[model samples]
Target: MPIVNFAVAVEKGKAHLDAGRPDLAAFLFGQVLEAHPTHPDAVNGMVSVLMQMGRADEAMALLRRGLEANPNHPDMRVNRGALYLMTNDYESAIRTYEGLLAEEPDDPVQLVNLGGAYMGIGRIEDALDCFRRATEVAPDYGGGHLNLGMLRMVLDTEGSAAAAEADFRRALDCDPNLHGAWLNICTLRRRAGDPEGARDAAEMALILAPHLLDYHQNFAECLLALGRRGDARKVLESLLQVNASFLPAELALAQIAVDEDRPAAAIAHLHRGTELRPQDPLIWANLAALLHRQGRIEQADTALDRALTLDPGNAAARMHKGRIQLAGGRLADGLANLAAMYDLPEVAAQSPFGRLEGAEPAWDGGPLAADLPQGGHLVLAPEPDESLTFLMFRFVAAAREKVARITFLDFRGLGPLAGQVPGIDAVAAVGDGADIPCDAIQRLGALPGLLPGALADPGATVPYLTPPPAAAKAWKDRLSALAGIANLPTIGLLWCPEGRRDPGDERALPLQQAERLLQVPNVRFVSLQFGPAQNELDELAQGGLVTRLGQHVDSPSALAGALAAVDLVIAVDGPAADLAGAMGLRAWVLLPHMPEWRWAQKDGAPIWYPTVTAFRQARAGDWESAVAAAARSLERMLGD
Candidate 1:
């Protein structure tokens, strides 16, 4: 080819490269290089094409040749440094950029590139310095400000969020189209608890780069943080439409499905995610969690096994496996898994038992009877859950006969409730400055484990709690007045389970199911159900099946009085049932198939509450059987 043809071919190659057609550009550049071997444009074009094609070695060789021909070519050196950075050769990229900085110390672009290389190599302090210097040298440069802001966020020290936010704002002011700066700002704002600001920034990022999946994800996360779950769901679903195999979007959608009680949809989304990223332990672990929630124990175990196989040190998977084992009644295996979790640093950090961190010798359940103080024992109450509190009352009652003095520490200010128990020397709120003298302290929940055979004795069957006399009298008088008009058996009905943490646990029977009890001849039903279920009470009243006493039954003392006034208490597994059982009332406690471990029955009744009859659901999530059985029992009690 003639020199003129070579020049034309080189120009065409450059045009094709600029137009994003690296393949055709490379061929044209190759033709030029064959005739004029040292042409700068042709050499640079070939190197760019090779780099775009991911042929790092060929690109580097071509760049070296170009530098050899013109040893002081600044563009060639810059290109070589960029190639090193692209290939993740951080040391080489750092060396090249540092060399350039030595010649042009104030060049913001070179400083930013060097900072990125330092960041790649985990020299975070050095990277920060480089970014700081770049921003200082060119205060108006939006890219430099952006890099400085991003590095500040990565540091994430006490006041770094404020600094990062300022820099990001500055960058956006300089270049309004800087989507990355907006994203970082959004994240920082979200972390700082400014969800509205985060949403605004995320929206700006999406407007700037609508096609970027990460921008959409950030927007969705911001929406979720702002509690706009519906909007977030739409955005996530739209993102899945754009890229179905996007693992993050799929995982988010699965979480949304789980929150919405759509377990099948959650499982389907997770299954698709696992197909897309089969090796990701988190995806498999999440799948296992959903399965565990559905009580698919064996399938959950299989999924967890796969997750642990992929990543042996997966803490979430290990914790989940332990919970599954416990739920499946494999106590030994479950405890072993939990012990493994206790050994894990991350797990230990999040555990409630983390406060037990020390080098003190751990206690196994050995003979510690001699360690019990003979004089005064201070019992620290567990969390204010009714079942736990009632259990504490039993332990206190049993220990009362043994210890000289027993002081109850009611953490949740249940003084009125605790006041009704007979044997306590005093009942004090935990933080109320009641200086009780005691020789020993014990957590209420730890009593059963501490004294293994003590609770199993049948002698512990007596009712330990009593209702306040005046309140009980008031309730009895009110009931007497109602009975004179009705001439029927007064039954306290608690059809709904209270304080449910998981929506999937259908322990609460539908009011329609309790219509069986209402249909029983000569029975007056009083509502013991509480907490925002007035609509349910109204529906029952409209049907003339039950009457509401929820307004009068407010305090724990009042609840106890109400329980004492009724002939029988038919309740789901909740505080109402526990209260009735504690008051020695005849409670037919309707239980789910998986009622809490404490409610485990030995002789058709809970061992903890001898007066309470256990009507347990035979199948998981099926309340009808338990409700029907309770109704039949009520019919027999009424002699109808």
Candidate 2:
């Protein structure tokens, strides 16, 4: 065998691979290996290039030949183990790594690979232990800390954020050029509601790895979170320049266009994505949604057909199809699809009891026995959001004629008020499922599909969740004392809702826009807001323009009572809006331009809530028109 400079040849091979010409890299590596058959660098480089080119069998043959020549070769051994991991042969990967560890103990890279194989097999505890050991043996190895940080987040997403972030930062401290550690820190910063910090970390990642598509995407996400739409778009566009077929960058750009209220631009991006990957169902599904929203029914239908054909279980496509059917008066079909939309992994993760996991089979709004051993018991599981749960109560109220007895397996902090709802016969906490009487169980979200006819019957569903009479009286008395003028029409109002809200959260309206409604004549406004939003009413309260229902606003029951006491409830789309709608109260539900499909209008009202009229922002972030319309409605309804 000829003696060649293996060092220079390996460097050239790597350079070729980095230049995106794996074939050239493979040829160079092949030349080096032919001259020096047992050279580990040549074997490893050639193997990597072959794998990149999807020539795994050829790569394996070359690896075996090299290993036979130099049986104890470290790089070749590690490459073989990594190939096993990549091929989903977790057991083989673990064995290979363990065998290697016997020869070279406490090797951080081998330990990290072993941890990955353990993770592939879902042995989370083992994976954690391996990752910890890798860091322990090689504290300066950034990869070990990076792996540990990622695993911690997966272990308990919200709970482990701080610790995971610390690990990521530690990794960056050990190796300043570790782009992956910086990327993880960016994710953690975003989760901690520090998008500025996230953006900074994302910038570090992008600077380190300008060629990495994932880092660019993360940087764009950080920008989006910070409400820098133009900057995010620039990042995503540049990513497309790097890799024209990058689906994630295309999706991100489309979402940014949606945020900017540029439906045409969003559609154009989705169309570009389709051209790049015609078989990708996600792009097709998204295209369908925008087309449907714009009333391009035929185009949307075509998109939906293409999406569903590509992936029959595509939830977004199915949900949009249902929306189209509902809009077209295909009631049952639409309801079923809407039902499917709720049955998503994200929704289930939001609530432990989002769906019934009872021993009894799920009831599909079927006729119940007049006398089950326990009197026709049926457990109603909850939806992810409180607003959705409130809507579920409407469905329960409508279906009261079918089931003899009801037990709501309430989650989502709605437990405090579940028993107070009109049709609920009993209420139980989520974990007390065993104690709850249930002959059969059903998900609250499933009600739409099960009882579409009943839900559609306004008479049956209306006023299904009335605020407690005594609670209402208490709120009314407080308002009467506070207002000084007993006969003035009282209005319950909300701008920002409780929980996570940002500038990009369209469901929340700016308080300044709502201040105009507070100045209406003849009507006294009651503040149905909590936390910092209540502070916005200080000036109005001082001027006697509004009455802040301070303590009552914090309690769910008291909030409902406030709604009952008011002559009208005008609010943004959230729990308050859903509560008013569920109670069949006269209310105005203000909507963003791209509201969820359930808020779609029918005869000037939300389709799900016949009594709640909607005032929609014609474009994103343009709530002024909607606010003005609500003010006029307020004047007509209660103003002098």
Candidate 3:
């Protein structure tokens, strides 16, 4: 053989492989291998070139011939094992690695490859043991520590992150420029609710390995957690340009759109994500939820079915499916779907209520105290949203008969309205409720499912909640104070009155958009819209357009009285709708093209509210149609 520059040839071949020119890499490797067929490095170089070119069968053939000629060739055996793994022949791959480990038991490279083989077959414990042994054999090897750390995360599914963090730290100690370790640390910190730490780690990972798409995705999530939506959006948009079909980048963009109050944009992003990764169940589930919100019930159901078909165990898919079924009146199926969400580890960890002085039995809407010698004291879990708390008050009245006493947990400002609800006992502020000696607790959302036909009582849907006399007097006096307030029929408006509007608030009907309704003759439009949105009211009030009415009412009962003072309430879907429906106040509820599960599949026929009428949008984000319909409804009402 002419003295060949084999080192130069192999180096040049590797450079070609790195440049993604596998054809050129194969030509150079072949030239060297022809002269020295049995040379271990030459054969390995040719095999790598063949594998890179996606000719795995040719690579395996070369490995087989080399191993046959040199039965004790370690390099050929490792190459054969890698080929088996590439072909997804798990049994062959595992046997090959095991045979290699038998010869070189302390080789961290062989040990880690075996661990990966075990992982392919779902033997996670075996994989974890292999990774642990690899680290034990080579304490100073960064690759071993990195593999150990990553494997520990999978093994310790519910354990503390200390072990993984420690291993990752050791990996970094072995090599400070290990981008993989930094990426894992970012993910670990984000999961632990340390967004600040996650962001710092993510920035380092991105700086170290800007080529990796996951670093960008992780960075965006960290930014989102820190309420940096604009920054997150910019990062994700740029990431998409690098790889348009990047699934995680698309999902993160969809979430950013939702945060910015742009549901239409959110839905568009989610739809594109579904197209990019059709088999991804969560994307389909999210799309279903957004569709269900827009009143596209049939389409939402179709998307949900596809999601469930792909992944029956997907928690979000199940929850949204349940909500859709319940909205469609399929109570049993909906409840079954909800069971997973309610049983999630996070939800299960919450101690909703404390043990009362006496025996506290869980009230499942069943007749309590029938068997227990000690009577049942039912303590209902507080609603996170004040509207839900009030909505539950009416139905909870029926539960009073099942238990000796019923105590409503007042967490979200429901303390004031407790007196108005016809129930047995006091309104215990959340913490105090646990000490009241109650035997059992129940989630207010579960009452309908627990007691079949229990909510069918006509009286429950009627005007069950009453405004306090004092609250009603305050609202009436405030209305009387306005000049000519009593002259024309009053219509309460709950649209968002913000100067800089949020596009994501689907229920937000901008005050300016109500110009047509304002044109309705012989009607006094009072501002029932509240919160930061009042700034818009102040701007219009300066020129004698619309005065803020919410500034006058502070409590839920007071808001209820304010609603009662109006002849007809025209508002978007929100707390006002919940109160209006509960009070049986005649109101026109402007609905988004896709409303929430609370309103059910149809707009006009809300089961909980008999007097309220729904004005649904014909297209997504088109409040004009719903508002126009409301204006027409007003014209008709005035004519009547």
lDDT of each: 0.75, 0.79, 0.76
Q: Look at candidate 2 and give me any clashing residue pairs.
A: none
TM-score, each model?
A: 0.69, 0.69, 0.70
Off by over 4 Å in 2: 1-50, 57-239, 248-270, 283-305, 315-329, 350-356, 364-367, 395-398, 409-424, 427-434, 459-461, 482-484, 497-503, 539-543, 636-640
lDDT by residue (440-552, candidate 3, tens digit) is 77766667667667555422456777777888888888888888876788888787522135756667876677787788878787877767776676555222545567776
Poorest stretch of ten by lDDT in candidate 1: 359-368
Q: Evaluate model 1: give its lDDT.
A: 0.75
RMSD of 1: 6.7
User: Model 3: residues >4 Å from true position, as ranges?
Assistant: 1-11, 20-39, 46-279, 290-296, 335-360, 370-374, 455-460, 497-503, 541-545, 601-604
Write candidate 1's Cα lDDT for 134-245 as tens digits. 8898888898899998988888888988998899989988889888899998888888789999899999999987867888998998888878888999999999888787
Which is superior by TM-score, 2 or 3? 3
Clash counts for the predictions, in order: 0, 0, 15
* Sort by TM-score, top down from the best: 3, 1, 2
Index of the highest-lDDT prediction: 2
